[model samples]
Target: MSRAYGDDLRVLVLAAGASGMSARAAAARFNIGIAAAIRWLRRERETGERTARRQGKPRGSHLGVHETFIFDLIEGRWDWTYFEKVESSF
Candidate 1:
């Protein structure tokens, strides 16, 4: 299934609303649809943490530090010119 940006935003809003105001009132203030606001409130009640996980520090960099390419680009290597040209071609 595809991602729902609206649902995600509603979840965030719901969480914030639960902390500050009544779910119905907060949802009404935000002008979110009534059904969606109720759904969000129920889902939050069911799960303390909504869909996404809390991000934490990872063991290592996924890209592993592309130092050589970055250094070459910074130092004005002639070979680097083709990279930009190729990127533009796409």
Candidate 2:
């Protein structure tokens, strides 16, 4: 699973740990299994914040915004006159 998934699971676990609901109630509310909810809550209680982040390995698309492209644009990649006109309107 990805780090985002772990973060989501941690959020669910935190929801379960809060005083407003039972395991089944939490599971149904979140559309997860009761067993899984209990397990995650237990793991969070036992492991602390370390369990909320990524583990084991990396996989999937490495999509990211390129800093160089941003820098070039900031330094005037598009026509400076066009940007100047837009900025003046703002």
Candidate 3:
């Protein structure tokens, strides 16, 4: 996936607004997409900041919360025959 434009590029794009350039024109001038330029300008107008927004929530394992319980279950299952029976049922 492509990364977001940097703060410097954002600032330059927004400066077009101050010079009375339309979002579409600015985007064309900078060779960026019109939607991106419009979104960035709107963000700066609403939040008064030109920095890139954080993308999403931090990464984590789905099984992390049950790690200890899963380990205990594995350790408690002493017989290979029990595992084979469970696998066959599934």
Best by lDDT: 3
lDDT tens per residue, model 3, 29-58:
998999989988888789887788777777
Most TM-score-accurate candidate: 3
- What value does the lDDT take at residue 47 in candidate 1? 79
TM-score of each: 0.39, 0.41, 0.60
- Per-model RMSD to reference: 10.3, 11.8, 4.6
- Local accuracy of candidate 1 as per-residue lDDT tens digits, 31-89: 76666567667777887645543245557865458767556565764555667845844
Candidate 2 per-residue C-alpha lDDT over 1-90 given as tens digits, one digit per residue, 9 for 90 to 100 = 533445665586576667667667777777777886776666766776425444676775453455665456557645567667457545
Q: Cα deviation in Å at residue 62, candidate 3?
A: 6.8
TM-score of candidate 2 versus the correct structure, residues matched by position: 0.41
The alpha-carbon deviation from the true structure for residue 41 of candidate 1, after best TM-score superposition, in angstroms, is 1.2
Query: What lDDT does each candidate get?
Result: 0.64, 0.63, 0.82
Residue 68 lDDT in candidate 1: 70
The C-alpha stretches of model 1 lying farther than 4 A from their native spots are 1-8, 49-90
For candidate 1, report its TM-score: 0.39
